[model samples]
Structures are given as structure tokens and as C-alpha cells.
Target: MKNVEIGALILRVVLGVTFFIHGLVKFQGGIENTVGWFASIGLPGGLAYAVAIVELVGGLALIIGLGSRVISALLAVLMLGATLKVKLAMGFLGNGQGAGYELDVALLAMAVFIIINGSKLLAVDQRFGKRQKSVAESV
Candidate 1:
């Protein structure tokens, strides 16, 4: 595969696995705790559940290269929200108090890249699209 395609695949897998673990941790920590944390930050507590489910499902979709653009878009939004809501005041570096927005910004940028360039290598999207095109041509 081309270097660019391989790079995209690597990015996709890493982002996918990262978010998946984050989502899993949220679940293990209890939805109530997640909701409480969200409310502490002034967001609607119920959104925690939605966010958890989206992160989990979106991460899976990204890993498999299915609906990657949509998942990336959603994740980008999530990262933006995290940066603005919780991490912005912490600056770029984390201290003993808490973490900073650096990771959020990086994730946001990567998500945006995936959304724009798309996942094309070793991806279900490629195979599915090609199959659909061939079927359409035959019809």
C-alpha cells in the first residue's frame, strides 16, 4: 500500500482503540458517575450516556472503516466539546490538578483529518463501495 494509505490506516486504528478504551472505562466507572461528572461541568447529565454510546459505536465503526467519515465527524465534535468545556482552562500542559487540552486538540485534529481524507486502505468502506458500484453497473 501507499505510504499515505498506510498512515491513514494507522491513525484510524489508533484513534479507534483509544476511544474504545475510553468508552469502556466510562462504562466500568458507572454511567451515574459519568453523568455526575458531566453535570459538575454544567452539561446535561443525561448526555453522558449518549456520549458513551456514541464513542463506543463510533470507535468500532472507525476501526472497521465503516461510516468512518460520519464517526470521525461525531468524534471531532466530542473532542471540541471536551476542549471547550473541561480542558481549556488547564492550558496545554497537565499538572497535579488535572489534565490539559493538548490531547483533546490532537484527537480533534486527527478526527478532522479522517473526516476529510477518509479511510481508503484495508477498509470495509472500500470493499463495500466497490461492490455497490459493480452491482449498479451490472444493473
Candidate 2:
């Protein structure tokens, strides 16, 4: 694979695992707590469930390179929301009260890159695209 493809794969897998672990942690640590936290932050508590599901499913999709662009787009939105809503006040490096938005911004950039360039190396999406193209040609 080309260097860019390899870079994309690395970013994809890292982002996927990060999101998957975060989602899993939310559930494992009692999603009710997450819901409460969201409500405390002035967001609808029900949104936690949606966020968790999206992170879990989108992470897995990204890791497997299925609908990578779409998944990355969703993840990008999540990162943006997190940075804007939760971490912006904490600042980029934070004030020692809580972690900053640096990580979120990095993740957002990675997701945006994937959305624009796609993750095709060793990806299911690549195979699926090839199959579709072949089928269309046969027709």
C-alpha cells in the first residue's frame, strides 16, 4: 500500500478503537451516569444513548473499513460536539480542573481526513466497491 493509504489505515484503526473503548466504558460504567452528566451539561439525557450507540457502531465500521467516510463523518460530528459543548471551556491544555479539548480536536482532524480521503487499504469498502463495479460491468 502507498504511504498515504497506510497512514489512513492507522488513523482509522486508532480512531475506531478509541471510540469503541469510550462507548464501551460508558456502558460498562453505567450509562445512567453518562445520561446524568449530559443532563447536567444542559443536554437531553436521552442523547447519551444515541451517542453511545453511534460511537460503538461507527467505531466498528471504521475499524472494518465499511462505510468509512460516513462513519468518520459521524465521528467528526461527535468530536466537534464534545469539543464545543464539553471541553472548550477547559481550554486546549486545560486548567487542571479537567482535561482539555486537544485530544478531541486531534480526533476530529483525523475523522475529517478519513471523510475526505477515505480508508481504502485493506478495507471492506474497497472490496465492495470493486464487486459493485464488476457487477455493473458484467451487466
Candidate 3:
């Protein structure tokens, strides 16, 4: 693969694994705590479930390279919500009363990069695109 493709693949894998672990941890730790935290941050408690599910599913999608652009967009929005509602006041450091949004911002930036790059190389999207191109050519 080209260096660019390798970079994209690496980024996608890292992001996928990271979010998957985080979602799994949240689930294991009980959504109640997530909900409580959300409520404390002035967000609806029920949103915790949605966020958790999205992260889990989106992370898997990222790993498999399916619908990566869409998933990345969704993750970006999720990170935005987190940054705005929970981490803006804590500054850049995550060592305090509340963790800062630094990681969230980084994740958001990565997601945006994936969205802009559109899942190139080793991605299911590329396979589908190839098939579509061949069919179109035949027609």
C-alpha cells in the first residue's frame, strides 16, 4: 500500500480500538454511572445509552472499514458534544476535578481526517467502490 493508505489504515485501526475499549469499559462499568455523569454535565441521562451504543458500533465500523466516512462523522459529532458539555472548563490537562477535552479534541480531529480521506486502502468501502466501478464500466 502507499504510505498515505498505510497512514489512513493505521489511524482507523487505532481509533477503532480505542473507542471500542472505551465503550466496552463504559458498558462494563454500568451505564448508570455514565448517565449520572451526563446528567451532572447538564445533558439528558438517556443520552448515555445512545452515546455508548454509537461509540461501540461506530468503532467496529471503523475497524472493518465499512461506512467509515459516515461513522467518522458521527464520532466527530459525539466528541463535539463531549467537549462542549463536559470538558471545556478543565483546560488542556486531564488531571483534575474533571478530565479536559484534549483527548476528545484529538479523537475528533482523527475522525475528521478519516471522513475527509474516505476510508482508503484495506477498507470495505474500497472493495465496494471497485465493484461499483466495474459494473458501471460494463454498462
Candidate 4:
């Protein structure tokens, strides 16, 4: 494959995996706790469970490349929240303790790219989408 395609694929997989793990964390923490955390973060209380569910299910959907456009868009928004809510204080240089906004920014970019370009090559979206067009022509 060409460099750009390879880069896009790698980015998608990495973002998918990273987001999935984060979602898993939330699941392990329990929806009530996650919702309380969201409230602490100033987000609306009603959105807590929805956000948690989205993270868990959406992260898996992203990993399988299912409904990639929608998943990427949602993930992009989530990452944007991270950049705005927490990362802004620490600055782009990170917390200086090896934890930084760099990962958040990268995830946002990857999700945005996937939203625009989609999951190309072989992806679950192909079969899951059930397009009349051939997989290569779906896009």
C-alpha cells in the first residue's frame, strides 16, 4: 500500500484500540461512578450514562470499523472534550510527567481523518454496511 493509506490504517487501528481501552476503563469503573465523574467535570448529569455507554459501545464499533464515519465523528467530539476540559490547563507540552495532551490531540486528528476519509481497504464496515456496491466501490 501507499504511504498515506498505510498511515491512515495504522492511525485508525491505534485510535480504535486506545479508545477501546479507555471505554473499558469506564465500564470497569461502573456507570454511576463515571457519571459522577462527568458531573464533577461540569458535564450535564443526564449525559453521564449515555456518555459511558457511548464510550464502551462506540469504542468497540470503532475497533471493528463499523459505522466508521459516525463513530469517528463521536470520538472526535470526545477527544475535543478532553482537549478543552483538561488539556487546556496543562498546555500542549503535556503535564511534564510523561502524560500530555499529545495523545488526545492525536486521537482527535485520527478520528477526524477517519470521519472524512473513512475506513478504507478491508474493514468490517464493508460487510456490516451491506452495500449493493462492491466493497471497493462502496465509498
Which candidate comes out best when scored by TM-score?
Answer: 2
In model 3, pairs of residues that clash are none
**Which segments of model 2 are wrong by more than 4 Å?**
none
Per-model clash counts, in order, read 0, 0, 0, 0
Q: Which ten contiguous residues of candidate 3 have the minimum total lDDT? A: 89-98
Cand. 3 TM to true fold: 0.90
Query: lDDT values of the candidates?
Result: 0.89, 0.93, 0.87, 0.77
Per-candidate TM equals 0.96, 0.97, 0.90, 0.80
For every candidate, C-alpha RMSD to the true structure in Å? 0.9, 0.8, 1.5, 3.8
Rank by lDDT, descending? 2, 1, 3, 4
Clashing pairs in 1: none
Best by lDDT: 2
What lDDT is obtained when candidate 1 is compared to the true structure? 0.89
- For candidate 2, lDDT tens digit of each residue in 1-108? 599999999999999999988998889999999999999999999999999998988889889999999999998999999999999999999989999999999999
- For residues 99-122, write the lDDT of model 4, one tens digit per residue: 568888888888898888887656
lDDT of 3 at 54: 81
Model 4 lowest lDDT segment of ten = 127-136
